[model samples]
Target chain A: MNVFADAIAWIFSPDRASGALPLSEAIWTHLAFTVVSVAVAALIAIPAGWLIGHTGRGRELAVALSGAARAVPSFGLVLLLVLVLGVTHKVGASTTAFVLLAIPPILAGAYSGVEAVDRRVIDGARGVGMTEAQILRTVEAPLGLPLLIGGLRSATLQVVATVTLAGYVGNWGLGFYIVQGIQIRDFSQILGAALLIVVLALVLDALFALLQRVALPRGVSAGRAPENEPVRRRRRGPTAPAPS
Target chain B: MTWVTSNLDLIGRLSVEHLRQSALPIVLGLLVAVPTGWLAFRFRPTRGLVLGAVGLLYTIPSLALFALLPPLLGISFLSEANLIIALTIYAVAIMTRFVSDALASVEPSVRQAAVAVGYGPWRRFWQVDLPLAGPVVLAGLRVTAVSTISLATVGILIGIDNLGYLFTNGYQRQIVAEILAGVVAVVVIALVVDGLLVLLGRLLMPWTRGRRAA
Candidate 1:
């Protein structure tokens, strides 16, 4: 009980800010790693996913790649990259690992969201002479918004969780306290840092869940949207909704 | 290459520990999740509350969870049990959702038919509902298995011995082969476990094989 109280106090103590990387700075650095990695991943994966979903090609490749990627432990990957790239380049190495980790969920979400839109609707849009790009922009994007956000939600959560690993490579983050505390056997510090990470992750998760709700197409939410049926997160072994 | 060749004994021991540590969580997770999932799936009122609570558990980062569990459980920070317990919590968090979803995947009419044919709830759940939920649950189990195997590597950070020791040790020693060995071993374990899961799913749910083939 006293340890718990001290952990709580540790989180709020002014002395915390006196660390090599101040507590606030550590948090921002963590957020920065998360945001930049996820953003870079989105840039590469979303467009590639859109292309795959639009053309209805390369999906098996996507699935297989993501499956293989998921099996690579992020910790080992980080250590390997840092070693391979040279420890002096730890930032690049860690960022690469983070981006790779973030890509799969976002890619899955992007492609699956677009694929979930009914084929007849795309046909209807085409029949009315909407160009490919326009249909993707106006029709598919709106209908797929909920799922795209879902993918982003998962990606963001994954990256946030993984960023806690940054300290292992000598980059500072909220994980520093936990990592360093473990070495020195400081239970209060470890618990406090863990508490911070849990709180931050949950808050972000909640925000994404809300975003998923708000971004859900009105028709889909109302249960009247046949065109967007089966918008739920793809089950682990989900076959790509068969292209009609 | 030289490092791996010379360190075969160490690698073998670490692999065995990794397998043991990861496998326990998957089994324990399934034991807890099935009933919790059945309850959440069957009871309308408890659905959101149960799901929301577990969903929150899933959000706690693995490293943080590993750090946080020691004091809470009144265990040593370096106990192998701490890693197992934390991974089990994660497996439950992940598998409970999948188990419920898997149960929900069974058609209502199928369940109704069992009830109509004088099958008691227990018999029906065991014979009909459970078999029907097998594929989806199996899918979820595969995910839980792979992830647990991978996440178990992080146990090294807390000083529990596992393949992840390679990562920390390799980094300090600048031995890339040692790190590569760790990554390969983890991936191989994941792939082997995943393959076993698929085979087990086929064995348990023979009906699914015909359906997929058709």
Candidate 2:
């Protein structure tokens, strides 16, 4: 009870604000890390993913790579990068690690989004004399837009959560406060910093959810099962045999 | 490499602790999520609310969740319970949606046939729905296990002892080998456990064999 009160009070206090790393600054820094990393990742991954999906090649390799990547612990990745690259280049190393982490989901989403579009539809587009470029731009990109956004959404969320750890490597971000709080054993400070992160994450999630909804094509939205159902089912792979 | 060879005992101890920390949450999460997911599946009105809430829960950052748990649960910051409880919360949040989906994926006709053949709701779930839902739930469990095992490493930030300790210790010491040891150890545990789950699925669901390439 008192802890909650103190946390709220701590968040609002000018004392905490006037310190070396202010809460507002932390928020911006955290967002910057997330934005920069995800942007770089999207630039690198989306094209490769589209090529793979459009040509229908290299999907097995991509899926296996992403699955393996998912198993690497984020904390270890951060530290390993910082160590390998040297602490002086910690910022670059951390960003590289974040980019590596973000790439898999975005790439998967890109290729799978295109792959999910009905084969008949693509064939129909081809019969109408649409160039491959026209087919990719008009037929595949728009229909696959929702899932591309989903991949972006998850990648953003992942980067946001991970940007908190940026402070561990001496980068200034919202995680700085949590790291500082832990070192000092200040429960209020830890809770307060965590609250800031939670709010940021939820706000971003809501924004992305709205984006996903808005991006949904009206025709598809009309017949689609719930928003998450398709995403879940896609990952179950082809081997999920129907009950005989 | 020498760091790893010299620290084998420490690494083994931490691996045991990591496995223990991760296992409880996976098991407890399935136990809790099953009923809740069944409720969401059985009841129409609560479906949106239940699924939406858990979806939001999944978005909460793992570190933030760990930090929030101590104050919210009135547990000491250093308690191992904090790590387990936070991990369990994640597992439940991740698994509930899968459970609901797994149940929903059960064939409607199969369910109807079970009901028509004199099975009560409880018996039908046990005999027909659950077995049918098993593969999907197991799939979700594998994902949850890998993620939970990976996420457990974050507890080192809050002072909990586990394989994650190697990360912080190595970072502070600038020992790249030590850090690599931690990463390899965690990944191996995840892979081995994931393999075990696949085997368990095969043994328990023999009918699923030769049907698909799992």
Candidate 3:
């Protein structure tokens, strides 16, 4: 209605794009926060997850760590870090908090992906005289690719949503608009900024969904079809494609 | 320590407010999600569309959603209703997918056996399907509860009262102890809620315990 019209007008206004707090600048800042957070999280989490899955050691530690990480409220963490590190390092503090938010899912994905692979498959690889490193690279990595991508998808979504908090610490992002709009009581700008965030998140989700489909191995994709068949054939044994 | 001791009454009041804001949404979410999830599961064609919509809802940032709701619902900008409704949307978004998946996980053979036993669809869902799906649904509830509790703190940014009020107040005053206390209190609430849910699940699904024992 009128509100929607106002939101559209706000978005299209030349001042919105040209000012000190330009929408494009906010968008870029949001993207930078997401990219850096996700990349650093992957660097830390994926290797640890892989090692746990590969060696079957530290499974308990990973589980406990993920639980503890999940319990820590993201807003409080950001505030605490900002306080501890001093607000002068706002970007560093916020980035650290975002990285903490991003890690658990990626770690879970990598470890569970490898662990879900059939023991018989690993035995076969060993029977064929593959080295440990070769077995991981050739046998485990491809099969776990879908889940690894899934982990990245979850991490990206979380970071995108969370990086908005950066604005609270005086860092720049789309959240700045929402925060500022609230302060000034500008409904149109608030709605406009929110729309941009929703669009950005949906676009990223779709791109990741495409990546998941493309990355899935052909053999695994074939295995997914039988579950949908109408005739309740004999339930496939555990040998069916591993769940992503 | 001195800061926390002096502010004990403030902490208690905010904790209660936080609990009210968070817990109510979860209860409301379960009520809405069960039916919506049933619809998604009952109709095969709608499953993808329904789940996709919920997934998209979840990707909307909490802050944006909070701002969007006051205008959309015609509520006051600082209304507690806005916080509750916003959190409810998130809870529904998360729980619907979990409910649908949990139902889907019910074994075909088990469902067929219930059919052969002359159970109608409604009775079968209530008895066979729901019981089997209980553990998964409970696990999802635990996750939803913890996340909702964490998210309720975001309201402090917009001047709603919750444990996060401590963070904002502490930051403005440059009192590190107050911020740390907020962090500790929120984490403790999350852990206690999670533990209670686990205990409740065990009590309700005694068969799981029996199976493990056997």
| Interface RMSD after interface superposition, each candidate | 6.4, 6.6, 5.6
- TM-scores vs. true structure, each candidate: 0.94, 0.95, 0.92
Model 1, runs deviating above 4 Å: A222-244
| Best-fitting candidate, scored by lDDT | 2
Tens-digit lDDT string for candidate 3 (A105-146): 888778877776777899999999999989888888777777
Q: Taking the true A–B contacts (Cα pairs closer than 8 Å), what share appears in each candidate?
A: 0.64, 0.57, 0.58
Once model 3 is optimally superposed onto the true structure by TM-score, how far is the C-alpha of residue B120 displaced, in angstroms? 1.8
Give the least accurate 10-residue stretch of model 1 chain A, judged by summed lDDT.
Answer: A235-244
Residue-by-residue lDDT tens digits, candidate 1, B1-214 = 9999999999999999999898989998888999988877877778877888887888888888877777777888888888899989988887887778778777777888999999998999989988888887887788788888888888888888999999999989999999999999999999999999888888877887866511
Quality class of the docking in candidate 2, CAPRI style: medium
| Model 3 CA lDDT for position A109 | 78
| Preferred candidate (lDDT higher): 1 or 2 | 2
The DockQ of predicted model 3 stands at 0.49
* Model no. 1, DockQ: 0.53
Candidate 2: segments with Cα more than 4 A from true spot: A226-244
Q: DockQ for each of the predicted structures, in order?
A: 0.53, 0.52, 0.49
lDDT for each residue of candidate 2 in B36-121, tens digit (9 for 90 to 100):
88877878778888888887778888778877887778898777898899889888887887788788878777889999999999
Clashing pairs in 3: none
